[model samples]
Target: MANGVLRPGAVFAGYRIERVLGVGGMGTVYLAAHPRLPRQIALKLLHQNLTSDDYVRSRFELEAEHAARLEHPNVVAVEDRGRDGGQLWIAMRYVAGIDAEKLLSEGPLEPARAVYIITETAEALDYAHELGVLHRDVKPANILLERRGSNRRERVLLADFGIAKALEETTQLTSSGMMVASLPYAAPEAFDNLDPDPRMDVYALGCTLFRLLTGRQPYPGSTLPQLWYGHAQAPIPQPSAVRDGLPVGFDDVILRALAKKPNDRFRSCGELADAAVAALTPVSQLVVPPEPEPQAAPAPEEPTTVEVRTRPVATTPPPSPKERDARLAIASVTTRLSAVQTRAERLEPAFASLKSEFSAQCSADLISNERISSAEIVEAETILTSAVEALDRGDAERALELTRAVRAHLSTAERNVDAVTGRLALLRAVRANPKAKVAEVRFKVHDAQMLALNHGTADQWQAEFDAQLERIDRIAAELSGRHPDYWAYITGLDDVKSHISALVQRMKRERRLR
Candidate 1:
């Protein structure tokens, strides 16, 4: 439903898709589970349209082959592999934590922390190398850190060896004809060599370490050729260059690993880990001193004294009835918003099914992601928390206004979540019956399209929906050429495409009126 993906309830090869973990260079990876097993796993599936590409399909198979041989605790384990309809998929061991990119977004990791993760990942790399598996794609997003366990230690897992094969083989291409990897993290030599080895991974790990320590990629290039020049010819920058007061020892370790020549880098993973332990060791923890007290302003050179004189002035009365009623209405809405937020927060821990439903119906939807900002939501929640504190301190007017502001923010998200539910339900139904009548399916698509437009999805979602439709059209073309038997399926795709296009045009008109 979300860009032609399987619904949460849809099962493929016995694994039920729960939610999307992320979209990767190769495909979308979803959190899934076995129908009878207690454990959850990750399901990596190729996009439905990309299934016909030989290069992409071969790369997927290569990933499966590469990952199946890796059995280390630090590397994500492959549980199963199969083809589901037009998509090829691999079920993997589920690591319950966010990726390094999400973590780094909050801020840079401390030297000690970054070193620990790097070391753990190095161990995984060493293990995979020993097994003759080459993971050329080593980046922050590929490195997953499991939630802290009872021991307060995190477990790290490396992911997506599939992309290592595909991107290195395929030149970046697009309608513009100059598209490149948004942030390619492969080693410098891999760009030309196209062969993987331990040293290649070591170089990538070094670059990943730089990002972890400083919260950004080493080279700030925006274009593919610029990035290529950066990796191949630009001088390697140290981690401490970006982060002040960081241990200087890291300069030696990082620079040597990022040396233009592979032979200049660390000879082995063991050697790299030994150097990291020293480079990452804390000479002293950074203890922030307390904020200084504000000093009173000094008196001017020419001292002036004001003469005390009481003057009669017209006095304003208290708020009139209309003003008072406006305040009361805001207060009432504030209370309602507070109750709704309470219910939402409760879903995080109090109810499992409802929490899952929200993630499925709202969080998993691509439209919701493009329309909403998670950071903004968090900020609004924090403001509401402060507003509640203001109420606790008996500042009724200030609390009422602040809470009302937060209510509007929450309402936007609440509306988005509610609006998608009906549309998504229809999408799920249509996928289940691809052979259904044109009129029957068109009705379902029409209903969903109307709901999307009413909820303001036309202008905001047209570009994304258009791209998805193009993919469907491509798939239809490929399918139609095969035989007469696929004509019905192509017709099904046509109905979906036509309905979506109508919705888009309707949205454009709506936007113009506004």
Candidate 2:
């Protein structure tokens, strides 16, 4: 192995490693060719250090076993797992596209598109939950999006069962002081160290939806303490509050999903996804309006009989062609005016919201080009005014043309406003606390190291490893402090963690030889 990475042409357990797919705290995943088959598989190898630890090894094997039992279309399949040259490995179906986490780098997905991905993930979660399996770690990174065909529509699949547990299993992997779920998306109960359940996954899934909708984590806390505090105490944030133009109903859906109590949340992941779909759907589209009731006939008037008209009542002439044409034009314009009025009324709220958000966003100094949206709104309003004046003047052709222009202008304005809102929201989030995520990821690294320290059963080198861990702890604290560039510290922490993992592996090998 080259620096713990299998080199190209290196065969292990009948699989030939082609290249590294991804590296995690526990292991490295590779795109490997199956010996007996013509297909490629994502082969994940447990770090040599982790394989020497009983708990970590058991958890690795459990991921394959638990995932292999789930046969969901939206769930990634586990092919097999076994030991190869003393390193534990798992083979799974190789998905071709990026995960949802990477997709969010392009910014929040369209509401419909985000909901579609969530819906697919929900089905996969419910499937596993039904089979007595709980994917304790349900975050965007674990949800793979496979874009297919010419249209590039994504096929969403829920993956990474590394921390999943059977319902009947009593083992608590957190015994090692490492949280099974990612901190940003972990449920409140997870911090409480409560028993594992499906609701925990539901809570994580809700957090995922929030991230997808806002391009920000639900809680932007800079420390592990602050993160858990936000989950347990901070009020659930409304998506519309983050990004303007989001449906108000989405707030309710996310609120329920992130409910402090599991029972207070959706009964299942499917229900959560259903609620998201419902939130995206308009109330006007949900049901038909009732027909108006017929008016009751007035009681017959009595004793008011009128005398017959006198003879020689003059006959009236039929309308002239010009008169008829004018009447028809008036009627046609009146109908068009009604339609346009209704359309404008429907858009009025959106325009008002844009105006309000633009005002609020200006104070933040985050959106520099908000003037474009402001000008668009003003121009659209001016066009609408011109359209109304033309209708009042009975210039039907001019009115029709101006009304179409108003609609087109409003359409462009709305699109621009949405773009502005997204940019404003992203900037605001970054300004507030970019280090929260770095803190969260660093906590994971530290937690994993602590877990390893707790499991290092060999006594000869334990004292030396403890001193190294203390040094790492000091370095981790410094990294979490006032760092000018957060990514620099993050990169530093990753290097530190990788070095520690390598040392642990070396210690295990030396102890075994002795």
TM-score of each: 0.52, 0.54
> What does candidate 2's lDDT look like per residue over 178-259, in tens digits?
4434778988888765555678989999999999999999999756687789999999897977997776557757877898
- Candidate 1 regions exceeding 4 Å error are 49-51, 166-184, 282-514
Q: Poorest 10 consecutive residues of model 2 by lDDT?
A: 164-173
Global lDDT of each candidate = 0.61, 0.65
Model 1 reaches what TM-score against the true structure? 0.52
Candidate 1 overall Cα lDDT vs. reference?
0.61
Pairs that clash in candidate 2: none
Provide the clash count, candidate 2. 0
